[model samples]
Target chain A: MGFELETADHPERLRRVAIDPLSRVEGHGKVSILLDDDDRVRQVRLHIVEFRGFEKFIQGRPYWEVPVMVQRLCGICPVSHHLAASKAMDVIVGAGQLTETAEKLRRLMHYGQILQSHALHFFHLASPDLLFGFDSELSRRNIVGIAAAHPETAKRGILLRKFGQEVICATAGKRVHGTGSVPGGVNKSLTAAECDFLLADSARMIDWSLAAVQLIKQLHRQNPALYDNFANFRANSMSLVAHDGSLDLYHGQLRVRDADGKLLFDRVDYQAYGQLIAEGVKPWSYMKFPYLVGLGEERGWYRVGPLARVQNCDRIGTPLAEAERQEFLAYAGENGRSGPLHATLAYHWARMIEMLFAAETIAALLADPALQGDQLTTSGQRVAEGVGVIEAPRGTLIHHYRVDDDDLVSVANLIVSTTHNNQAMNSAVREVAKTYLDGRRLTEGLLNHIEVAIRAFDPCLSCATHALGQMPLEVLLYDAGGAIVGRLCRASGGGLSS
Target chain B: MSDVFLLDGEQVPFTVGQTVMAAARAAGRYIPHLCWHPEFQPHGSCRLCTVKADGHFAAACTLAARPGMTVDNRTAELDDQRRTLLQMLFVEGNHFCPSCEKSGACKLQATAYELKMMTPHFDHFFPDRAVDASHPDLLLDFNRCILCELCVRASRDADGKNVFAITGRGIKSHLIVNSPSGRLADTAMSLADRAASVCPVGVILAKGRGFVIPIGERRYDRQQIGAAEEQ
Candidate 1:
């Protein structure tokens, strides 16, 4: 079952509260909770009701056409979907070939996504609380507030995001759903002028990002209560494309580790993803709760994202990210699993770490000089199944496809990051209720904490739900004497009422 | 019938059913276009791609090649047609090329220059229309539209969302968003969407980068953006 049972108050007590029309993240999702008789907690079902038949949609589409087609997945993370889908085709077409320069170029494009996405997450979504007070009236707390409160930060974040956009705009000819990346390699290569511009822009952003990190860190320290119990529950972590388990975001092997920091799977064969990971589907939602091999049900539940990647990687190559990781570990309250890090705090730390790595990687690539060479798209013929997995800002995004002899995609499957973390979020929500909600009064701060904790994973519901719908979060309560205790106040975020 | 060689220098075993443009792209030669998108039905309303096919003038987008066909995409006669078409489009719509954001990167501008269209052959239609800045992340400047119908095709074909359509007729014809509200803000639109990116001219512009990159540093400023098709 996709639902998790939480022991609430008394005897067989179950009440359904559905969160419909989920907002702030992307797309839609709904969560239904069944409360026990004592108003404690019963079963929590996270339903991804809307299903996009993309797998069926792409069945007859030519392999070469998959990239442009899959770009429809999400406007925000189109690059990730584009790259992942293209790489999957590359493997299927036996075009398992990308020049070293092409790989670096791909990384350069990927870095654009990293910068833009993290900026959007930090500035557009989460920064409202920091720039403006958390309780600064819902009507006033928005991107407009950030612009008014810390005008320079908002302006710089926007500029940085545009710089990243320009990098994509330069190479792919458009910032959004670009037609540059193809099966074997990139369609267009960057000129010296473009590369120079990208390098210079990224370098400046790195300076701004470091200072911003400090500002965020200070804010985190001031509001310890806001982030309390954020990391109380620790789950197994997983990340893909990290070579030698060192903060690799784009291309390499995958690593899965237990909560105790023990390596469960290292550099596992990506082609056999179906065998290694199994998705359990429930009638309640479209989101398939994925589990580790043979872990069965709740036993195999795991989490993946920035925190997971940082924890699983032995070291991040970049100096700043490495230092931050060290600092986080040192002050991690003895758990040392990157687990105790609060959701609100994780925003700045993970963002800085990612920013540091993004800058270092792009700079290294630009300095390589050979990246200015041939943009030839080497091709090959192949008829095999291929799987490409990369960490989008959300978490591990996997694209698996089977192609026919005619080079048309016959079958497709995608295991988005949000899906992987769905179960973990359910557990977190339960814990949040138990800790904050005490069945008494619903404070806006508690509601904000619940929403912030969920947003910490930076869930991209468009990637999760795939189809169009809404996701809403509702809360209900009952007294121990089998009497209605209180009307469940709704959680402060958007959700689709299903 | 003579064999036509592709610009990419690939010898695509001549197909009798397809146009020269198809053959060229199939051979890895990309021919840029305004009226020709792969997913949309072809409309040769924009005669920007006139080419010499087997010693005769032909539009590559609509003209299918034959066996043993020797077509010259770069020729004097075809270049003249391209210039005339571009100049006509310039004068046909309110193409304030100087004030236009699409000046450098515009396919209309690129083709006009490629054909050495130094002067407008016809009188320019300086039509006055209201600018719709209502859309959240996109801008609509009706004064700069070329009426290429790319936006229409993009909305209907690519995204399955037909948010744009051409209204009026002849010189009076202009592109309009789906709703009579005439404001993209009220209509169904999103930032970073395919419809927003489809406009060929400065009629629709992404809000953020209006004057940032400037005219010279624009993407198509360096290369002959629509040259291959013109050739």
Candidate 2:
């Protein structure tokens, strides 16, 4: 993409550079880079200008509506929100332990959901950036362009996503916004036909997922210096881990580790998450910043998602993915067995590994005779307040709720995955901005750099804001006097303007 | 008392004082209505049952059946008008189907599907309506109310509690609780009351039981409303 510069809005007094509607990302958001008279970058902020009040408005409603209601947050990863909310309601209904069949069905739905979402993000959205250089021509750098150049790769991505959707349909009923999982258990389990349908493609999907990881690793090897150093920094990490300390995406205790791989907290009950984490808000952005309460806001801000989860967890649950995780930890002959990988670009590799795990998990769940069991739900003593935490494809997603005696939800607190990574994304964008600043204004290369940095986390602004809007890249530069000096915008349709 | 009328070419038998809606239902026919319930007196509020009775536009829920009379129930022209009525009901109020607990079993949603209503075809009024969840055993979501008076009629007639009523006119029309505090908790309504489950839509529902019946197993889930004996 190229832009023709014009001082139309602010004459020769260049003050601000903004990338409005950041492109190839999930939702509408922009980057504002405040500059000084010396043309030096001052402050950079990623803002969720749209306000979505799902937290406030969710109150005074019946508790069962939650699992389906919250899916309105994001189309990409709705199953995560659905499962997280359902888990919270399970606690509300006093079903602390679910029947084996119910748990298996829910797990199957989740794996299908994460598999499809990761495939869509890696292939449909982020692949163009990797296949073509970040600074490649706008017209020639997109999914369509990639399809023209590498048809087999593009087809694999589509088929992989399709297989995931089919699994969701079998378990949840329909793909997007399905009502499969209820408070105590899922509505239904995988039928014989459904099991057959999924099993037919399980081996193929695992193969494709392996290929994707290999592809990203090869891409990283081509330019390790840029891949490793670009927008890289040391940061703390967090995710959910199984009781045995294996990678658990569906359910587990909360764990947090620092940059040097020091365990700050392990096996913290998610119900006590309120004591461990506190949320911070700024006036500019609607999205909130969440940090470990012990560390406070500024120092506690850490990274989450694929990168964070891989570094935080001890091992992957599935054998194939576990092997890849080991290889990834030893990248470039560096022993990461006892450390965290700080490269943001490694998120792609981590995501593909997770996808492989999901595929393998799907195969295991289908073979279980529990899919045909009659024990579908369970109940115990009820609780007024409940909290649910799951490792969403992005990272730790927390949903807490309190119900009145009447059973209407009185309080709701949702720390979405993207909200947890808010500070990390802002810092990543800032690092890219500083490195790619050529002179007075942002070039196409700088804009692409910012996009590539943000896209790795796969941030969903709609989910972050809990509102709806467009997504593309735009940067605004404002002088110290607060007047906007220069601006660059990339529309969602890949049109660049200045 | 026994009378026969031709409804959309089928012979429908009726008794004295029976409305077209009653006669049709008694004879295994479904006449769509928002305000009429089987166990209550007809209020004829929502005119979703608009029909051509002997070549005159009439509400089937209120129109008395007469022998040797012809009534057109599901004609294209009448359905067009009925669709417009349903559309107005939809856009005027918040009828979010996917998230509503009453989604799979709601008659308003089922009838809309029966009529093949593709879209609302008008700008949404989006009238502000507040939820009344004050009652421990009940939740009143007025946002989905079509002003059908099924709850109103059941409360006043069957339950003899007079716990509900409708006020205002035209677009300002709304459902109100017949209590000093204007909340269901203050009324005599209980989980056992017939008024509690009379809502043809999602307006009056019991607390803590949302989505208890999974979607696929709900009343209208497996078959179209028309194919079923009743909504």
Candidate 3:
């Protein structure tokens, strides 16, 4: 892939570099780098080419169909969309608070989603790069290679993912596109057998989850500089936190923390998200840049997902994860002195801790008798507008809908988790490209360093970019003469062949 | 008397005048199908059930079964065609599974799973369609319509109201209402009508009844579409 580059200093000279289709990530996207006549990096942008006009097309559909419809946005995080939309519907239907049974069941399903999604991201997607090294042979830097090299670890990963999927199926109805959550409440309750089946392996899942956390910690210990300095930059962080400031992925108020760990806002009503957040548009990408409302575009942009979640929250409710959180914060400094953790690579560590918390949360929910209650839904007069927000495995996900008197959706807006990280991802790519690619010859391994930076966020381009196509990664190099000096393309399976 | 035929090396029985799809269903074999509901007259519009019978391609839902036909239903060549058909149907309409209320139970989605169709394999048409919610008790999302014509037949024959019909042809073809007002609100359609439930996709849905069955316990979630019939 190629694009015409016009630099400020050298308007006459043109240089272009492109990564056509970024691999090992969900959906289609590419990275473009522009160099000036002096051979200095001029600009770096991650372009999301897929245009999913879900907002425009979903306008006329009934608000009740939203929860099910929006989940189709991403296969990887359908449950997040499902729950977020359902919550919005709950507001539309005038049931601001769900029945105890419905709330607990939805929370259980969400945790299962987070658990499975994190397991997949860590074991299947991220581990290959971390374990095999970014510069390793492309063939050896994937889930299959992990399976071959570390059989037991791979097995645990698969089983962990299976357990999470089983939990989702047990609660929601099906693994992928479950229909369990609805407006005002859930449609089904957990059967005793389903609960028992999950509990049977809960202990083992927890053990394996802890081990996974330890593994990431060890990886970080081995290469502190690489993990810390690679695309590391400070920015605002956002997540949902319980009233007590405990981590609450499923239900909580919105909280935003500046890079210095200062709380900009806390316990803000999610329905009031419009007042707290505003989106900035860029000509280059389909994804919108969302920033905190009061901060304006320049400083308002924030990071979400695992790292942001762990940094923004005070403590995780579960004991094991809370312990891990304490240890993780040591890297950022004690008592919030050094500000929120900005080490981009530490996202993997934060993800593992969340996995542990999900397992523990699942166990606690299973033991609650409320999970089996028969009250599945509440009914009331429908309202005209509603907003739903939740912490997807990636980060804070928002769904807002306005229905007409006919109950058809008249206006729809969604800010997915990856969109929240769009600005941060671009900043990270710029940093990595500037540090590694200024005068050095572009190589496959060097290009991979950029991909590695993007991978740390575990950005789901499908949800973020919304293209209904495949995009393979390509990297182009330009010399001072404004000519294509070198090129690298990623095959479908992520092998970097020049 | 039932006539015996060899289907994929299994001895299967078919009644005279019954189509291959019906015969296969009778023998507890599932040839992937959409728009060929058992209760309705065979439409054969979806063409998903095309199987090789005696070295020729024919729609299983319409082709009459004969004794010793030696039909090959599960061959790679036929599956590939079915996969292609499913992909085309996916791109033709906005069949976003995650947002579809009928997703788990939708016949088109189930057929795609049976055929192992991975990607849409073609550019998405991303067609713009309308959602008719004028009817207080019913919601019709035309975006997901696969043009199966099951609703057309069910409305005409079973409900006897002629509330629905197909208009246009080829890519321009779409489901239309029969009322003078050109809206579902003016039609005699009700939640109790057979046409309301006949849609295999998310075209016709009871407005307030969405997500009535929790995801895991839904019809297809418990078992594959034809799994119960297989048993």
Candidate 4:
């Protein structure tokens, strides 16, 4: 019993919007696009229906306990939550100046997560369509199908994924939600034996990944019509942490570039994100629309995730990973132009390249002896405003927190990587509509197209939607004259954001 | 008091309040142990951490560095003792090391390999222990427990909450949660709880969260962690 908004009024177009248990996604969410008389998108509505109320609940709590407390966000990317929260706390408590070894260990964990999550994406979730025909039934379209059809490849994927997770668990404390990382440095130190084990396995992982890259290429060749050539969309690109004005995932400056090889901005200070970008809140979806700071709402098209990071960066960092980067650069438009790299097909290629870089980079970090620091936290508890930034598997994630001297969080703002691409996502969603929808009733192909558009950014709703616990979706819609049209709402089991 | 021990070829100061195992770790030596987690009290359950202290087999983790006390962490007798201890651990529990998820990270595996003791060389106990998958995020398989008491120590001391306790005697000795439900799944376990990640064996597993890291690439597949003590 929910209402669907078909049409809405001018100026105050949207009165209500409804989104049911959105199908086939990992979590639940809703989106409503308000339209004018001519059916042009007038206002975008976004509302986080369920309230985890973490902001309210976390008050007066011991400040040091936030990392473990926040790890409940998403099981898939607990490290991201742990690191982001820890970094934020570092700003609050004035801590976490880790040794070279500590920094390496921390980056190793980030790489481990990147590899594990991307492997899960390619092998379990996305590969089914390519391996089996795209038209395969929803029931048969799963990891089991991948296992039955290509056991070796599936096993390889599983092993690499697990290995990445195990590396983090071994160093951090737990596989899903490790506590070894603290405010200052890591609580756990690696023994020589542990280091050797990680090194040997990661070496093997490099080889296995190269083989998988070949498999992906083969799959691309096998189904070029359906899978190889992806829908093309072009836009401006942005990424966090660039090494000397190039893309560096762990610690670099933020870079934004236009589609025509023109550098819009490079290594911009993190504190200037708001001054550089502005956000628009719609009454339809909970997603925030970010536009160029002064341009006002949705004026510029921006993209993030794999393709954007690759294009924004000058080159991949690691020596071994450089080869993969070369391969990516070889195929895409010249070193200067963005070209047709915005398609979903490009995400797979960029994902594999990033996987190699993560493995190699993490291996180097674990081998660093200085990381075995004596302290994981510091003494001072000076609260300050700070921003913690990291490139999540999906894209760049930022956590900006304002706290008082007591180290209690005062104001918290998050700019998720997925939300940064909201305009680009809507553009692609409409592009998919132009390419496949053809005004047909939402067919399976059309739905797949929409999924494909979202998948290009590899949106992590858990990260994008940062509320915690028992969140439900509520949608309301109204007519052009501000008349009630339709509504849909339902409650769901909500999870914590790590 | 200043003391010294001839390690490898040179003499080094033996400080007070330092366990022989910790000294060995600090001096950059490998002394394998399962019941001697860095954060827990010593129980010497597995007995693989045995070192030659004062010309006798002693658990390095619990033995203090004393004035004029000589310790040999690497010796033929100590190797033989570790092998015997591993053999006993192998014959006493349902340690199907091959199928165990903790095979790589297991202290037992590290100690066994360090002592060159691969084949159990004993009859399998094959105890049919109950497995609990009741917790929202952890697993407990009693069959695989070697009675190291690390989990108990981790729960009681490190975590400041005694979630587990030992029951029965001798061969009947088994670990049990303190809850009336007698199940691990029923406990209030957050991932932050040391007990959640402190198990040295596969007996206590985190449920719905294994197989993410594949074999040939496990965290401990290649190197021994204790070797860091040497550096």
Q: Which is the winner by TM-score between candidate 2 and candidate 4?
A: 2
Q: Residue by residue across B1-231, what tens digits does model 4's lDDT show?
A: 657665543565668888877776766666777777666667876767777776777788888877667777667877787788788887888775533557667767766776788688888887766665556556676777778888788888877778888999988888888888987656766667888788877777764233324343455665665652244
Best by TM-score: 2
Sort the predicted structures by lDDT, highest score first: 3, 2, 1, 4
DockQ result, candidate 2: 0.55
lDDT, candidate 1, A471-491, per-residue tens: 234444444444554553433
Best by DockQ: 2
List the DockQ of the predictions in order: 0.03, 0.55, 0.53, 0.02
Tell me candidate 3's TM-score on chain B: 0.96
Model 3, runs deviating above 4 Å: A1-14, A36-39, A137-139, A334-337, A464-473, A480-482, A489-498, B1-130, B141-179, B187-203, B215-231
lDDT of 1 by residue, B1-231 (tens): 236554423354446677777777666564545577655667776766666665676677787767666666655666676677777777766675533445567767776676678999788766666667666567777766777788888778777767889999876788888887867877777765677786767777775333334233666666676434333
CA lDDT, candidate 3, residue B221: 74
**Model 4, range A1-498, lDDT digits (tens) per residue?**
001122234457433233433333334544445444444444332233433455453443334445555656566777876677667666665563655555667777788888897787777666776667554554455667679888997898899899889887876766876665566545556667787888888888888777766777566556656553455666777787465655567766778777665777777877667777777776555667776775456445477777788767887778766777676666565446445365566677777778877877777777777556543444365556767777878777776777544444566676766678766766665555445544343323334555555555566665423232223544455775667655444345322121
TM-scores of the candidates are 0.66, 0.92, 0.80, 0.60
Please identify model 4 stretches exceeding 4 Å from their true place: A1-24, A30-52, A95-97, A218-231, A334-340, A371-383, A464-498, B1-231
Give stretches of model 1 more than 4 Å off: A1-16, A33-43, A130-136, A223-228, A333-348, A443-445, A464-498, B1-231
Model 2 alpha-carbon miss at residue A39, Å: 4.9
lDDT of 2 at A334: 65
